[model samples]
Target: MATPRQDSSPKGFRPAFYRMKDVIRITSLSRPTLYRRIAAGRFPAPVKLGGRASGWSAQALQAWIDNPSGYAAEPTADDPAS
Candidate 1:
């Protein structure tokens, strides 16, 4: 029998914030696509966690995934943005 793989997410790290690798996994987006969105200001900005570390908020990513169309649409005062 095969053993189940264990989840390795750090316990201290809130699920609301995820590492770049985790964001990639959640979005299933290629590196180029990710970079393109970032450049276009169409995606959430990553937070610098350390000298060489960055992460995106899981809440933001999940919100995007949950309502992709809404995510694509820029925030407007009429829409209240959230």
Candidate 2:
């Protein structure tokens, strides 16, 4: 049997994404709160991974975590849904 490999990559190696659960865990924010902030453009918007999947940029989230007060509000898009 093959064993599962752990995350042994070096830092700044590649793009890292945080799913909803990880995002919540890292930010300590509830799901609804996260979504609300996203809608309000007060938080980093998540990237669409596919038709039904989405993820947040780990770098962006880490930056926000490092300096919450200095974080800039995301620009609003022309689309009403955005």
Candidate 3:
């Protein structure tokens, strides 16, 4: 049997998937404002988890948290110019 791979990151650390309510609590942004920023490419877009469910990536949220003013959504392959 092979030993399990170990994560060298902080204990209890894992990629978080934050729901709308959690995101509101974390960023203190209203739903409308959050949507506006996402539309403007000024914030990370939430990923679809399943039917009628979506959430933001912790890494993406961290980028915004680190520099809210300078944060810009990274272009994805879906983007025309990307």
TM-scores for every candidate against the unseen true structure = 0.63, 0.68, 0.78
- How far does residue 1 in candidate 1 sit from its true spot (Å)? 11
Worst 10 residues of 3 by lDDT: 7-16
lDDT score at residue 57, model 1, on the 0-100 scale: 75
Show model 3 residue runs off by greater than 4 Å: 1-15
User: Clashing residue pairs in candidate 3, if any?
Assistant: none
Colliding pairs, model 1 = 16-58
lDDT of 1 by residue, 15-74 (tens): 757887888887888778887886665776676888998888777776678875556634
lDDT of each: 0.73, 0.80, 0.92
The digit string of per-residue lDDT tens for model 3 on 4-75 reads: 998789987755788999899999999999999998999999999999999998989989999999999988
TM-score between model 3 and native: 0.78
Task: List the candidate 1 regions with Cα displacement exceeding 4 Å.
Answer: 1-14, 72-82
TM-score, prediction 1: 0.63
Ranking by TM-score: 3, 2, 1
Q: What is the lDDT of residue 48 in candidate 1?
A: 80
Which run of 10 residues does model 1 get worst, by summed lDDT? 73-82
